[model samples]
Target chain A: MLKIKNLFLKKDNFILGKISFEIEKNSYCVILGKTGSGKTMLLESIAGIQNPEGNLYFDGKDISNISPNKRDFGFVYQDFALFPNMSVEKNIKFSARYKKIEDEKNLFLDLIEFLQIKDILKRDIKYLSGGEKQRVAIARAIYSRPKLLLLDEPLSAVDPTFRNSIMKSLKEIVQRYNTTIIHVTHNFREASYLADKIAVMLDGQILQIGDAKDVLNSPSSIEVAKFLGFKNIFSTKILGFEQKNKFFSIDPNKIDFLKEKCLDDYCFECKIEKIMGITDHYKIFATVKDTQSFFAKIPKQIFMELKLNEGDKSYIFINKKDVVFI
Target chain B: MKDKSFLIVFLFLGSIIVLFLMVPIMNLFYSVGVNNIFETLQDKETYESIFLTLKSSFFAVLFVCFTGIPLAYLIARYNFWGKSILESLLDIPVMVPHTAAGIALLISFNHGYIGDFLSFIGLEFIDTTIGIISAMMFLSAPFLINGAKEGFKKVDIKYEHVAQTLGASKLSVFLSISLPNAKNDILNGALMMWSRGLGEFGAVVIIAYHPMVAPVLIYDKFNNFGLKFSAPVAASMILVSICLFLSIRYINNKV
Candidate 1:
């Protein structure tokens, strides 16, 4: 329902461009990137709130040059941007005052009730907590029932407990309303959980865009894989693959975790370099045979059982079938 | 206590200035009883001068609102090549000698294209109520503009962006979101402009001395009949100033 083609933007020394993506009707698209990756700039460009050299098509209309007010898009800022002068109800009602999509009140009631902001509807914005402010901001944005919803790091400032519930409610609300969404965040976990299609952006360009699992499991390049924090990314030739596709590969099945250094089967002695915590999983980086460094993603139980620490010696088992050509 | 010596030093330094300011106003109040101020208010000329002062200053604030808000919004939100220069220029009226401002205004607005063009339009400023208002607005506009700029600066621009994405036009976002959020500072600016305009003397006297405001009338009374004649008018002006000051303080606290 929404397509951005060859979007180019230059702000000072930072440039973002050729950002092309399409979101299906009612689909959730997440723009994932690191800090200063121009993620928010791309979102603002698509929202038509910033100047960009590109074209955007929504519902078969070229809306590249239209004002933001005519875009029929909802935006949730990272800061929530709740109107301090208005109560929660009035802030939500403020958006409604500008545009009326239909002669319907049930949707507004559902939003207010489902977002769990009805209790604080009469309270001033200053008195609300961070989570409460986010709720109100979303309610205000959705009350207008815009065709597209653009969220710029909506979960960044939210408490962890509220973040999960907010994501769940947002997904449910989007499905119920049949609204397309594009969310920009530097957090991969949020993207993995919330996006139907994940677009990985680095610097100013998009490196990969596909299903969340596809991007995570097999990134297009080692750079993309490294950025996505894939544990094992290296240039290893596959035994049976054609010469054209044998150069880039990943070991899909995790390497075996060894408590003591043992050279048995496809085993190599290595020194632990770093351990990155990924939610409940653990990613261990170790140098193999003092020549090459490789990382292994193991279950937290296996990692704890081995009790590995940085700079400690360890061994890992690898198999031929574990290699997957990207 | 650890703070005792610091507290004593602070009190000693602060009380001297406080007493220096309070002594004259208190002595003025002691000399002019409430009966004198009340009798002065009974005079038609005293009432008209005070009323004219308020009326002109109110009109001055209205003019400032018309011309100053957009400039303030620009200064607060955008940066341009000469933005800093423009901001400093706005403050020049506040720093310049009022008598010099009067002389400059009188010369530029005296039978020149601007003055004659305005005269042809039947809106003369020389020795007229229009001149008083013009002088008041020229002298007081910086306050309103500066205060409003500070107010607009405090409002996060993200709200306007979000409002626009939520389908609010630029004007709608400004009116509904920006204005109401900055209402306190805007009101403060208006009060400052009005109060400053009410007390304007040098420019107003040079431009429109015949139709006197409260300050000009007191000055005239002092020059013609010495201290005794002007004391009651001064007391009445102080009473009005105190009332306005108290009301502003009360509203500020509530806000």
Candidate 2:
């Protein structure tokens, strides 16, 4: 369990926080933000690598002023900072040399085997590929069986094809070790897939923090909604809702072409302006009476069956349950 | 056509300097008779001077390693007041004329308060092995310190951060991570310092002229005798120096 309260960090002109958040024990917490949003800075502050001006509690122990080495946390850098002077095996065993790790040999073996880095155990770090380096770095970090693990863009350097498998392995590592994880990434897909809790960070503050599903389904503000890729956000007055000074957003995938109105469906007429083909779906951009525009992500199969074309008149339907008021 | 002409001109200019460096050393070999070179090698005084040069330079490098490494690490890792000024100050010895550097060393360690203190403690630099080592250390220390500083600079701070998070103490991380990562540069610096110390003349000559290092002995030979007598010693020193330098470099590269 980790609690960061009013954590403040300043490096030159860049300041991060007044940040307050808590992660449940053994839960995966993802800090999601764009580049230069102080995501890494916050992670470093939590790791005690950067001196921060607030209280940090781990398992109810105030560890704000503890040295990084004494925090018993493992950090995986974005660049997979493996020791260049050591072989993969030696790197994995490095923490064992300094700490009194029980079952050190078994932990080392399990990590290398689980991370699939056993083959390169004798190879120098310089000869490894980026993906291989990442695996080794992970193996080295997990070998110590640390209580908490901080990952900075762990899969950014891996090939896209291997990312899913690596993510699965990371989750499995957390589960098996019972290690609380704080993963920092800009990719919403990664956060949606891996996080139990999500913290949306912008500039130097946490804009929203909650259960991943809650944050995903109902963003707290327009900024958070836009960041989560909500495509249909409009003032309630434009949509004719009774609510004033309120904005509502609907997930693109939830909006559909209407045939007949259902009891809970909100229906409106729009003309298709443009249709763009994505990987496995079509994104239909439509304008409501040539005023407010919105895009809907329609499944390729459904779009093919409907046989819709640009500039065609269509009815857009959204269920009341899908509308999120912000 | 113009590029080709410019290339030719550059090559011509480069070759002149290359030849300038090579010709004199080659002439030393050519002018010295083989028997004289063998005789110089066999001579007790000549070999002793060469041995003294090697020993003094080795000790100088040892001293630099102990004192300069921590300073280099500080300069590389931290930003504090007068950091740039401190870095510039380290290079002053290289810029100062060797004779002036010799005078400065003499005034500081042999004739000044430090000298008096050292003498009171039953240690004196004048005309002693310690004097030779002090002179060598004074002139060659900058090379090692600067080299090590640049080396430490090149090591990514992320590695150290990660090492610390892996439960390595500050000292452990430095010893296992920082120092080993900067090994090549430190080695190169030591070699440069040692090589520089081997050829030091002006400072060592002023400090200790009796227990002659190779350079001082060569100067003494050339001054007291003629070119004919000194050529063999110079040739012998050069051959040994080249052989030692090349062998160490080869070993360093292989490792």
Candidate 3:
């Protein structure tokens, strides 16, 4: 396990605010944030590339003063960061040599085979494609068998199709090595797919931390909810609780779509504004009472059967359990 | 179709500039026949001057490479107090006239302060080969440093970080990655510095008048003997510089 406590790193005019977190052994933690939210800085601190003004511990040992080479953590940067002067095989072997490992050639060959870069072993780094370079970088990082892995936007620079395959490969590598990973990204889909726990950061502060689904489904604040694509969030007074403070909440994905009118207390009439066909479902947008707009996803077959169109009027029955108050 | 008038105007101006630059050197070569060139090659003074110039300039380039590369890397990679000041200071040698550079060297190395202290310890700079190397180094080292720094800056720092994470020490990363990657710029800088050192006249004349380099020897020959006596040596130096410059360009292409 790795633990970071009360870390405050100041660089120029930007300050990475006091932050703390722990990564359990063999677990994948994804840090989600927008651009310039100090996600990279935090990861660099953990990797010992950027020294923070606090303590860091690995397996209950204090590592705050350890040098980057002594940290024993594999760090993969966004740009792959392969040495341009070395060939593919030499690049992978450099770290293994530094760690003074026996049977270095066999280990390097194993990694090259695992990453499927065997044919390019003799090729210079300048000749490798983007995906190949990233694979080489990953192979080099894991060559020393580091205790933890830190990846900063590993798939952000690749094509969308390549992103899926690379992420899957990375997940398999982490699992096979039983290495704890702290991955950072701004893409919600990657976070939802890879993270065992998610930490949402904004303006240098971690705004929320919880399970990925919990953070996505019920954010702690209107800003986080909006950032997570909660479309129907509102700041309003409860109908019967006049003395209570004004609260903000969102309609969850459990809200049901209605084809015809029904006598229900938890139903609201709405006009269909837009309909979008997604991979497995259709996203339906409706404006309720001309004041609130909500989005819902239904099965594509049901959507085709109903044949919903724009400007159509309908009622959406939102379950009370589906409404989250923040 | 191209406009005949504009084409004529451009070609006319270009020809004039090219002639203005090449005529003096061409006149030197024309003045020295093939027989005179062969005869001058056997002259002991001519060989000594050429050898001294090449030797001193080579040493000056070596010194610049030793000191300038690390300074460039530091400026390119790190942020520290007075970084901008240090960057501007690097241009000081380039902007100052070589005559003034020579005068500054004379004052610092003369028997007043540093010169006296150094002499007490057994090192001398006045009228020595070391003085010639120093003068050439002062006026030309900045070109090397600035060029190499720009090259290193273009390389991604993540490469070094990756090397570090791979277990390579800091020095190993520099040797294995940074030096090889910046080889082109380093070579270019060395070429510029060496060529500049060879052509340096004012500073070397002030610091070391005896054991003359090619530029100072050319000036001495012209003043004492005549243009006719200096023409062969000047042509020889120009020919050698052209060959060196072309080789540098070729290497740059390969890199």
Candidate 4:
């Protein structure tokens, strides 16, 4: 288990303010955040690479001021900072040598096969392709069987096509090693697929940290909603209770009742400014209050059936209970 | 000149500079023929001075390897207080006049607290081999430190962190990751410092002139008997230096 209490770090002019969170042992935790959100900095601090001014309890020990070598945390960089001077075999051997485990060789072989990196073991690091390098990095990190595997945007440098395969490989590796992981990334898709817990970090502070579904379906604030790629959002007060999208089916009974008074509830009143779509899908861009814009995606059939056009007034209702007020 | 003939201008300027450098060495060889160089090499004093020069410079670089490498690594990796000042201090030997550096080293080694401490240990600097090595080190250390520092800077700190996380100790990470990665740069720096130490006359002459290095001997011979007597010794020294330099370059490039 890893517990960070009121972690504070001041790097250059950016301050990672009083961030606090925890992850259970052998669980997959993804600190989901945008770039420059101090995600990498926080990881370094936990890995003991950076001296953080806060309490870091790992497996019931206070490791706030310990050095990185003693932390026994496996950290993978985005660039895969593999030892270029050492060939693949040497790199893995160099790391595994420290374990001096009786079964290190067997364990290494298992990881190589599981991560699908056995083919590149004899090649120099420079000779390996980008995806190959990524696998090698992951394999090397697991070679020592680190207590907590901390990956900083591990797939950011790999080919986009290889991302899905690598994610599956990560799950297999985690299960095999039973290692606690804190994977930092900015993509929700990755979080949804990999994380047992998702921590939404924005502007240097974790705004919300919960189950992946909880954080995604109900983001705490507008900033987080936007970060999660949410559009067509108006004030909870202006949107009545209904998790409705312009796309797909709309309940006629609910639509008629949504047109009724929902003053105290969250409902959005807007004028359609423009419509954009081809084929079955349509995007309705609308003006809410003077300058604020809200966009929704609906089916082209719905647009034609309703005879919707520019300047048409519309309303998107959000159920009061579902309206997340931050 | 037009851009089309830029190569002509570049080649012409490069040839002039190359010729300017080679002409003097060529003149030295012509002045002292191979027979004269062999005759100078046969002289015990000429051989001994050249040997002493190589020996002192070698020890000086050895000392640089021990002290300078760690200091360079620290400067490259950490941001402690006075880091910028310490970095600037490493360049002091290169920036100051060689004679001024000799004078500064002289007082520090010959008198005061440090000099007394050394003497207490029976390591006097005045007219001693230790003095020659110390003077050479003082004049040439910047080359090693600056070179190693540049190499260390180019090595990403991420590798060090990864190595540490892989259950390697700090020293082990440095040896296994940082040192090997920066080996070429550090060796280049060591070579530069070694060559610079070979040519150090101003500092070594003041501290220990009795056990003369090659450059000091050449200067002394020129003062006593003019160019004719010293040219052969100078030519031999240059030949020996060029041979060692080429051999090192060959090994370095091969590696």
State the C-alpha lDDT per candidate: 0.85, 0.90, 0.84, 0.83
A best-first ranking of the candidates according to their TM-score comes to 2, 4, 1, 3
| DockQ for all candidate structures vs. native | 0.79, 0.82, 0.78, 0.73
Residue-wise C-alpha lDDT for candidate 2, range A1-73, written one tens digit per residue:
7999999988999999999989999899999998999999998898889998999999999999999999989
Cα lDDT of model 3 by residue, A1-326, tens digit: 88889999999888996998888888888899999999999988887888889999999999999888888899888888888778888887777657776566676777788889989989999898888888988888888788898988988778777888888887787677668888889999999988888999888888898888888777888778777777666545432345454455545356566878666546778899998888988888888878777788878787888777999998787666667766
List, residue by residue over B109-194, the lDDT tens digit for candidate 2.
87768889999998888899998999899999999999999899999999999999988998899899999999999999999999
Q: Would you estimate the TM-scores of all the predictions?
A: 0.90, 0.92, 0.89, 0.91
TM-score of 1: 0.90
Report the C-alpha lDDT of model 1 over B134-238, residue by residue, as the tens digit: 899888999999999999999999888988987889889889888887878888899999999999999999999979999999999999999999999999988
The i-RMS of every model, in angstroms, reads: 0.9, 0.6, 1.0, 1.2
Off by over 4 Å in 3: A235-265, A269-290, A296-314, A324-326, B1-20, B248-255
Docking class of 3: medium
Q: Best candidate, TM-score-wise?
A: 2
- Whose lDDT is greatest here? 2
Poorly placed runs, candidate 2 (over 4 Å): A242-245, A256-284, A288-291, A297-316, B1-16
In angstroms, give how far residue B76 of model 1 lies from its true place.
1.7
